[model samples]
Target: MNTNEYPTHRLVKSEDLNHHGTLYAGRSAEWFVESGFVAASSILNPKNIICLKIHGMQFRTPVKPGECICYTSKTVYAGKSSLAVYVKVARVSNLESIIVDGFITFVHVDEHTKACPHGIVIKPETEEEKLFYKRASELGR
Candidate 1:
């Protein structure tokens, strides 16, 4: 793990689950996207951000209600006004493991025209970010 990498924050919501007694897949996906948003914004433009799209979602397990869901995200790649964020989710309560993992794409847009502006800056502060950028670039093509 990269020491400089930002530690993920926890997100909890009572209405995020479904009647199945387990966390809903849709809710999990949304949370994952939100996590990506948090991570991307913190690195790219801490003040303003916008989610462009959710690329894909994959669930490894189901999260339970009352369990603290932790979403960890990192800046994988950035270009102009767009940044790709990779995120992973874990269900914690008395020590549990990952329940889901995914990635989200965000575009920094001007609030007025809602168009992606030029010269958006993203600084990769760790080796992890560099490696992620390389990997993401390869996969992106």
Candidate 2:
């Protein structure tokens, strides 16, 4: 795969927190999907893309207020009309610790919002990419 990463950063504010004083799941999900969309759209027209599914989201840790969370997304797999994007969320100060990670699938559509082929193809070039490509294919099945 290209392994091109699209990164987005967000500051955890009071409004982004939950009752337990940590980042809310809803907010995180929104950003995660957005990041995935960016990755998918990078290879296709943004106006022709729509999110089809969120395969899974794993939250390994909680994010607190004042922390700058970075969301990095990359396209790991692509089918005729769909792309699987993997997103990783971590603190900018400590990229080693992943706060969350997930895969989202997006489809290319025509002007009528019907599924259409996206002519993009990705070839895995590394062991990590190969693993993610395999996982993405399994998710499609």
Candidate 3:
């Protein structure tokens, strides 16, 4: 896989906040899945893709309102019909502070919404890529 990082950002607003004034989990999840979908759709037609699973999502830090959250996603692994997308969300002002991270699995489907072979193949060319690929492959098992 290429080392390119597909990025999307959202600003935390009053409507996006929880009772604690932090970003809400449901809102975060919606964006996280959208990020993964964008990453997977870059390789496969968006119309042919559907989310198959969402692996562990861990929120390590709270994001407050008015903060610009950056979501970076990458295709970590590719199988015959599925792709594992790893996503990381952090504050744009404080990149070191990761708010959440997770993996989302997407599969290519036909017009009937049945899984179909995407014929997409990815080979890791860097150590970091290799590590992510290994981790994503494990999710499939």
Candidate 4:
């Protein structure tokens, strides 16, 4: 496990695949963003946070029916009013084979939907953490 990262599972079915018989990019993206939203909401009020940027979602494998995908998400960086979450999706059968990965940036907002500081800080302890935090910070610019 990576810090407070959590696993979210989704079963592959007919509706999730594209015409070419592989998982649809659109569907994968939906889950990616949803996982990031869940990560942010776990720390802040769900109503107080909204997605700002996706950074990027890189698809690395093709998934077919009968395969279960696991999405692992964690808040990697907290800056002022923005929080960045890193997510990795892979099949449950092969944990080492990553199907997709990305970083998503979210902003904390007030009741009026304006950006507000969350006053939280995350100290990157290991090299991996530092790398993710660095990449997340780049999305701000």
Give the per-residue lDDT of model 1 (tens digit) for 34-114: 778777766656555777777657777766666776677777776767777777677555234667655677777675636
Q: Lowest lDDT 10-mer window, candidate 4?
A: 1-10
TM-scores for candidates 1 onward, in order: 0.71, 0.96, 0.95, 0.94
Number of the top lDDT candidate? 2
Q: lDDT, candidate 3, residue 105?
A: 95
Off by over 4 Å in 2: 1-3
**Whole-model Cα lDDT of every candidate shown, in order:** 0.66, 0.92, 0.90, 0.89
Q: Which prediction has the highest TM-score against the true structure?
A: 2
RMSD of each: 3.9, 1.0, 1.1, 1.9
Candidate number that wins on TM-score, 1 or 2: 2
- Model 1 / residue 35 / CA error / Å: 1.5
lDDT ranking from best to worst? 2, 3, 4, 1
**What C-alpha lDDT, on a 0 to 100 scale, does residue 125 get in candidate 4?**
89
Off-target runs (Cα >4 Å) in candidate 1 are: 1-14, 46-48, 93-96, 117-131, 138-141
* Per-residue lDDT of candidate 2, residues 1-141 (tens digit): 475999999999999999999999999999999999988888888999999998779789889999999999999999999899999999999988889998999999999999988888899999999999999999977
TM-score of 2: 0.96
* Model 4 alpha-carbon drift over 4 Å, by segment: 1-3
